[model samples]
Target: MVENINIRVANLQENYLIAKHLYLMWQDIGVPDESIQSNWLEITKEYIDNARHKLFYQAFIADISNTIVGSVSCKIFAGLYPNIIKPEYRKQGYIWGVYVEPDYRRQGIAKKLMEEAIAYLKSISCTKVILHASPQGKPLYSHLGFDENNEMGLDLS
Candidate 1:
């Protein structure tokens, strides 16, 4: 619902900007600078490299006046279930790196980015889509009809 915002599939030329957006997203979520500074660019580069060869990987960007203000990425997860299972049953889409600039928030840019990611996943026939919601982004995901799963975690540290 954001006026004049264009959402489109991101290309290799925009990987660095996507990485920047991801770094800002982590910072917004309170990740330590040391953790993000040393590795974010390299990590995102690797992901982009893999995405070039993997049909399951897709990224979307929200642009206004040629400036990217928001972004999202999705990857299809092929479950560990045996190959005997049907493909549709084994395929799931996992969304990540959803971020919007602080100045551009509340104008539905993130929502539009998510909708594009979801549509891409659906095009590949993924049976379900998933994403780990940040505290600030949980409401948007919920409004988009995402349900919480019983996933639990442990910190060995």
Candidate 2:
């Protein structure tokens, strides 16, 4: 494990860094910059703002000796379908933006961030936590006990 790693909840002022991490994550996974909007930072910031207001959103940052190396974001999921189920049985949380710098990866930074996010979701009384993992992230998530669910998608293009 990397020594002196500090994981802490992030405030609104750090949203820009979180957005930057997310953008880097997409690029790492082969998403072309040209495919992204010119105002991506503003878009991500707006989304985080809305989620913080309308959903129980929270973000975490990983700092090693005062330098930030990673971040993760989680919140109560806003489902695509009507959420009519009882909270006790179906309150689900969503985790996203699980990112770490390439140099800091494989040193457990992402794992620590994920652990922090999981604990936060549990504290919020979430019955389940869900995340869409990238190919490189699937193994780590699986090791964390995330099972494969029946979520199928198709490309219309």
Candidate 3:
């Protein structure tokens, strides 16, 4: 078993790997393929690029035993309706895409990543943070002070 883990800002070298892993995980969890292929692709690329260009926002990676096991990304979306978040690193604050390897669940990797994400967001003067959690992630997010939102969405496409 891995003894220790590290969390830090993701670099360009790690972006593709993290994005691919997230794509697979999201697919396995039944994220609609079309959405994953299109929306997520754009969002991931934007986050990766933003992480490279912008210091105010970043994507954090979690590594265990020197292997990247999970990640949490946060960015800003300007001019979106108070609750409408942008997927292209345009949110006014941080929106995370946090995932932990299945085998590593319950080990607190995600939690640590989240804590780091929040700290980073605060450092950049973020007033709020948000994430869309799966059923499995709901408990962890709730434990971290996230609450359910009573919002509705309509696909204009």
Candidate 4:
């Protein structure tokens, strides 16, 4: 299955498909439809706009038999703290919206997408990368050498 997969850079024309994959990823992680459906289009539009800007955004898709089966998006971090960090530790890249169709799971498609995203970040001189891993994805990320950070969160609701 992995042998037949091809990784390619995504364009604005594929924004809708990327958005669909993102929605599926969220759903697979148990995000409520009510929360995702209501603003899906807007969110997709924002992705398109960000991708178009190209200052810090890029998306990649996994193609199998000319069909998109998985996707991952990456962005260069523009946070204020990054500006203060040492040069070698600055210019962080963030990976997100990783998804593979149910039928494509366990086929290494996600890994390929991540490799492509990481290569892109490296080409752009990103010194570090980060992602918020879903429970199902933690193992894969860990295998890829991604370490856990000390981020904490609380629900005000």
Question: Compared to the true structure, candidate 3 yields what TM-score?
Answer: 0.76
For model 3, residues 1-157, the per-residue Cα lDDT tens digits are 3459999888867777667767876876787887755666668777667655763657788887688888877765343456554343433465556787788878898889889988877777666776777788889889999989875789997
Q: Which residue runs does candidate 1 get wrong by more than 4 Å?
A: 78-84
| TM-score for each predicted model, relative to the true structure | 0.91, 0.98, 0.76, 0.91
lDDT of candidate 1 over 1-157, digit per residue (tens)? 5789999999888888888888888899999898665877998889777865774788899999998889998887644455475766766888889999998999999999999999999999988898888999999999999989998989997
True lDDT of residue 99, candidate 3: 80
lDDT of 4 by residue, 36-81 (tens): 6678967786866875586578899899989888999888866645
The C-alpha RMSD of each candidate to the native structure, in angstroms, is 1.8, 0.6, 5.1, 1.8
**Which candidate ranks first by lDDT, i.e. highest?**
2
lDDT of each: 0.86, 0.95, 0.74, 0.86
**Poorest lDDT segment (10 consecutive residues) of candidate 1:** 78-87
What would you estimate as the lDDT of candidate 3?
A: 0.74
* Cα misplacement distance, residue 52 of candidate 1 (Å): 3.1
Tell me, by TM-score, which candidate is best: 2
